[model samples]
Target: MQKGAAERKPGETDDELLHKVGTGNWRAVRLLDYPVDRILEAAGAWKAQAAGIVKPWLVWCAHPDWAVLQQKLVLSAGWTPIVGFDPRVSHVPIVPGSLRIDFNEQLQLPLMYPHFPVELAFMWIDKIAFWHSDFLLAHDMMERVATQFESLPQGECFVTHPGHPIRTRLKWLLNAKDARYWELLGCTTKEASKSQWDNGTSWWMNFQDHPNCPDKVEYERRAKCYYDHGSGIRYWHQKCGGRVRFIYETEIAHGHFTKIGNPDFKRSIPAGQSDSLRLMEQDMSRNFGLVEAAKKMRIEDLLSSD
Candidate 1:
């Protein structure tokens, strides 16, 4: 008789067990260290009562402050915010009833693993939205998106706005010194280098109806490629057969450096460049005020509502 599947003996490393049983053994594959099942169950409950509400799931990493602000904005806009967070960061102070899923201990993989959190969100909801932490949503953004979604033919599955050409050009110029930028763009010609891709700041999709929806394995494979090679836009464009609609003009404004709490733009600028420092200060002075005002309004509302 064939032996029963080997149980994970005491002290057996996760990698060893994974190799032994592979991913087919769901019991052996410990995906998250935290009580994600509980969180997802709570989300399911919330979703039951979420009729006519715009519920968007956001993924957070290395930016708790921004997460808090974004959560408040989501709440103020009358949308439900589901945040998937890196457990390594301090707990984000979100209002009660918001679902927060910790992902730091989920998969024993590199920090850049982007697939699992998104996949987790999709599993729970048929139609879901995603936004970057750095984006500030206009109060009417969700309403606009809902209107657009309602108007689209059943075949047109995904909706988002075009990338700001100015911002795209700026990013390319700023990263020109980095070899990673060249590798990511995969182009030697100036025209190819200058090409602008769609900004993925705020987008929603009905994956169930998406004609080109990929299976789990293919989706994860593409996600890994995105993390390793910065090819997410390319992957999405190709998968959706280059058929994406741009709706709701400028519903989201990117905070860029301020949203990430990078006061000095250290990540983008070369060190000790006085000109760059001055430019960063000017930009931050204008942009940070906007973020602060929005944050303040949310805080006041939370206090008053209580």
Candidate 2:
């Protein structure tokens, strides 16, 4: 019994995307209907925010559905897709750049949204998180790496995907460097770990049964425009059950509350009263510590064929 996708304001920053979880802004993170270029622009904008210099980081999600678009980006200008991975996805970790962006993002699409399929949403988020991260690196190779949205101190927002509580209690881990990455999918460091049940220490955004799992195509829609090229397009089956919706809703909830990585149930804050603004005082400035976001040099390695 999770809430439905919220409605977004006429024009909102990505930060508003998280409002639905706690502030109850009620806006759906609906980038699905927008044009592919729009998505690229969104990716580019976030990249500019993270990295001081605006270098084009050609990015595409690993999902096969986006394969055509990936090719187009590479062919049109300077863009490439790699250095991204989805646990549910196979054969990724595309390596065009020296830095690989990683992160988990959640969207609360309805079980019966006529136009969008949850699977597609998941693919998009997974890809965008990577895209944004690399976009930052592609831009000005800085000494410091900052997030697009205001960044919270490590353990400020704990996200976990199959996150481990035991690990949190221990707090022993270090990510690789020269590899610009974001835990977009849903992750939390030791400070952010909440004991789900002593089940595990990894704090993650746990949606009960996210429809994004890519079950079966609900129906086949003619690629109308793209079909002229004969690359058929398919959408997710909206007929999914509640389990699917529940999983997404759960993660949406966890993402907002525990974002600062204070997932401890006792740390719950009143909805709409979150410290997000204070949290994101700046878009992402190199002057800041960017604890999780460390900068890298050697921009050419990003698209390296290595």
lDDT of 2 by residue, 110-220 (tens): 111101211122222212212222122323312121132113333222122223434422432342111111132222122222111121111111121122222222111
lDDT of each: 0.37, 0.25
What lDDT tens digits, residue by residue, belong to model 1 across residues 1-306?
221222345666655443321111222333222333643354355334434544444435335555666566556655566666533334556665466654433243222122233333333344444554444544465456545544444222343333454564476456622111111001011111112112221011111111122354443343233222223333444443433454322334332334234564433345543221123223434455544645543343433333
Clashes of 1: 0
Model 1 stretches astray by more than 4 angstroms = 1-54, 59-62, 108-115, 119-122, 146-242, 247-251, 254-264, 267-306
- Which prediction has the highest TM-score against the true structure? 1
Strongest candidate by lDDT: 1
lDDT of 2: 0.25
Mark the 10 consecutive residues where model 2 has the least summed lDDT.
228-237
